[model samples]
Target: MLKLHDYWRSSAAYRVRIALNLKGLSYESHSHDLRSNAHHDPAYKALNPQGLVPALDIGGHVLTQSSAIMEWLEETCPEPPLLPPAAADRAAVRAMAALIACDIHPLNNLRVLRELKNDWQADETQTKMWAKGWIAEGFTALETLVGQHGKGYSFGSEPTLADCYLVPQVFSAQRFGVSLDPYPNIRAVNERCDDHPAFVRAHPRHQPDADTVDSNH
Candidate 1:
């Protein structure tokens, strides 16, 4: 069986879980509690020098980075494609994915928030505002793009790599209390994903390591 190093609430891991579920591939989950610094353990560090979550152990090799793993899955398991067939459509979907994975998520992720609080001396309110600012900015741009490109899902009728990146970022935006009302297209896509079996299965709340207590970090 495949082994996936994961943390329940990690957005990166969440994206991979969605991809795995969408492809109907099964994997074993290994939880490392980020709150308790378990990701910094020497063993996990040995597995991934960066000590990031969502490392996929596929027999002889381990894959790190959610984007890379999803691409690998697409290459290996091409039955239910995550990308559109047309080259331009594929690039458009990838652009949407990068908007979230690169522009939005990185600015508001746990590590950046921690840096804001610890090093920058930002209070909770300020840190939340910081996250909200970036999320709102990214979503504003994404709304326009999705409005133009999306059919039912982010890129088309079927869920694509764009949706894989989007659902988690939407979750993060909600966690930071970013308002969704202004982005109807994004909201519509999220609503559609809410009913998707793959997305339902990948939700952080359903993970084995999920905590009953809510934590923003």
Candidate 2:
């Protein structure tokens, strides 16, 4: 059986959950409380050297990193493709995914925010501002890209990897109080995804280890 080491609020884990749901794969989720340092446990580190929220144990192999796990799933199970068929189309999807996962998300990850408070002595307000600033910059550009390439979803009429990445970033952004009104197209796509079973089931609040949060976000 496949097992997923997950944190409810983790955006990367959220991406994988969506992918698994889309692929019709069943996985046993092992919840980790990130706020309580459960992710740093030695046993968890053996599975993931980086001690990340998501580490997949499957078929006698432990896979680290969310993107790598998604790619592996894509290769092993090619039923409903998360990536488009065409080379250029796939590249476009990856580019958008990278914009969120690489460019925006890394800057505002939990570790980075924690470091800001612990190492740099940044207050809550400063950390919040930092996160919003980075997300706004990336989201503004993504808005234009989506406006040009999207219809009801981030890449096209159907959900793609771009949508998987986009939804989580929006979740994290809203958690930190980043406004989405500037990107009407993005918001519309987010709304559409919110109604999707794959996205809905993968939402943080829907997880077994979900902590209380404002439902309005």
Candidate 3:
């Protein structure tokens, strides 16, 4: 059986959830409470040295990193391909994914936000602004890409790896009070993703660990 170690409100975990659901894979969910630093527990650390959520145990192998996990699922189960077959198209999708995971998310993740408060003495208002700024910047570029290269989804008429990364980022932005009205294309793609069963099941609120803190956070 497949097992996924995840936290409900984690954007990285949410990406993996969407990929797994998009592939129609069945997995058991083990929820970790970020509020309590459950990710740093010895048991989880052994599975993922980085002590992050969305670790996947599948077919006797354990995988870490949301991007790596999503790629594995795509390579192993190719029916509902998350990336286009064309090399250029694949590159474009990967670029979009990187924009969120590397450029945007790292700066605004829970750990970064907490560090800003503890180390730099940034208040809630400042942290919120930090998150909002990064998200708006990323979304601005993504919106332009969507207008130029997107179809009904991020890349084409069908959902792709880019969409998986995008949905979670949008959700995180909304949680942090970022205004998304400037990115109509991003919101349109998000609305399209919302109608898909895979995206629906992968929603943060649908996870078992979705309590008030997780949902509102």
Candidate 4:
């Protein structure tokens, strides 16, 4: 059986959930309370040296990183494909996914927030602003890409890897008061994607651990 170690509100983990649902794969959910620092526990560290949530223990072969896991899922199970068949189109989708995962999310993740508190002594408001700023900037660029190049979804008419990355970022943007009205194309795609059952089940509010907190998503 597949087991997914995830945090309820983690955008990275949320991406994996969407991918899993898109593939129609059933997995056991293990919720990690990131705020409690459970991911830093020594035993969990043994599973993933990075101590990140959304680690997949598939038949005891551990996998970490959301993008890596999503790609692995696509390769291991190709039905209802999440990526385009052509190599160039696949590269384009990967590029859009990376724009969010690599260029945007890393700068504003939980570790970065912890650093802002511990090292920089930033208050909660300032930390949130930092996150919002980065997200807004990234979304601005993504907005252009989606507006000019997008058909119905981020990369094409069908939901692809880019859509998986985009939806979570949209969730985060709404959380931090990032006004998305400026990005009409992104908002439109997000609305369309959220209508899917896969996206609905992957929502932070619908997660098992979400009841533990008064989640706004």
Candidate 5:
């Protein structure tokens, strides 16, 4: 069985969960409370030097990084493919995924928000505005891309790697009070994903360690 080092609200971990569910692969989840700094423990550090969530223990070998793990899943389990067959289409899907994974998510993750509040002495309002600003910027660009390429999902009628990345980011955006009204395409995709079994099963709220406490970013 695969072992997944996870945090219920980590969007990176959330992405991997979506991919794993989409691939119909089962994994054992080991919850690490990011708000409590459980990820910084030496044991987890040894497992993944970066001490990030969503590390996959595939038998004896381990895989870190949500994007890498999802790519590995796509390669290992090709059925119900997360990427398109055509190279150009695949590239487009990757670009959409990167818009959320790289451009948007990195800036608004828990660590960055914490840094803003703790290191820079930003109040709650300022931190929220910081997250909202980046999300709005990214969503502005992503809305155009999704409008151009999306049918029902982020790329085509079927869910793809783009959808896997998009859904979690939407969750994060909602958490930070970023409105989805400006991006109907993005909102529509999220609405479509809401009914998807894979997406529903992989939601952060459904994770083993989910709690009512407002500890997420």
Candidate 6:
């Protein structure tokens, strides 16, 4: 059986979960408690040298990186396709996905936030500000892209890879208090996709590891 090593709140891992559900593939989920530093354990490190939450063990062939995994799934499954048919359409979808994964998310990943607190002495407030700032910048560009080019969706009327990546990043933006008012297109696309069962099930609160979060929040 396929197994996914993941954290419930990690957006990167969330992307993979959505992709897996979209394919309608049954898989086991192995929770890694990020707050407890379980990702750094020697056993987990052996699986992912980067100590990241999303490491997919596909019948002994380990796959790292969420974007690559999503693309691989699209290629291998090829039903309910996550990409568009035209080359230009596919490129546009990929461009939107990269705006979040490469430009915005990398700067605000778990390790980066931890380093800011540990090495730079940034308080929680400051760290949160940093996260919001980058997300806003990225969203501004994406909003424009969607507003000008999007047709009821990020690329077109159908949900594609862009929608999969967009919804999760928006979820993180909301977590850090990034206002969604400025990105109507993104919010609209997110709202439409959120109604789908695959997306609903992929939400952080619904994951197997979700119970680990403190109830106080």
**What Cα-based lDDT does every candidate model obtain?**
0.93, 0.91, 0.91, 0.90, 0.92, 0.86
Give me the displacement of residue 134 in model 2, in angstroms. 0.3
Candidate 2, poorest ten consecutive residues by summed lDDT: 208-217
Residue 146 of model 5, lDDT score:
96
Worst 10 residues of 1 by lDDT: 208-217
* lDDT of each residue in 25-144, candidate 3, tens digit only: 999999989878988999889888989888999857789999999999999999789999999989999999999999899999999999999999999899999989898888889899
Which should have the higher TM-score, number 3 or number 4?
A: 3
Clashes (N, CA, C under 3 Å) per candidate: 0, 0, 0, 0, 0, 0
The estimated TM-scores of all candidates read 0.98, 0.96, 0.97, 0.95, 0.97, 0.94
- Give one digit per residue, the lDDT tens place, for model 6 in 83-110: 9888887898899999999999988777
Q: What is the lDDT of residue 111 in candidate 2?
A: 88
Ranking by lDDT: 1, 5, 2, 3, 4, 6
> lDDT of candidate 5 vs native?
0.92
Quick one: ranking by TM-score, best first?
Answer: 1, 5, 3, 2, 4, 6
Top TM-score prediction, candidate number: 1
- Candidate with more favorable, higher lDDT: 1 or 3: 1
Off by over 4 Å in 6: 212-217
Residue pairs with clashing backbones, model 5 = none
- Find the candidate with the highest lDDT and give its number: 1
Between prediction 2 and prediction 4, the one with superior TM-score is 2
lDDT of 1 by residue, 11-110 (tens): 9999999999999999999999988889999988988999989899999999999999999999999979999899999999999999998999999888
Residue 20 of model 1 has an lDDT of: 96
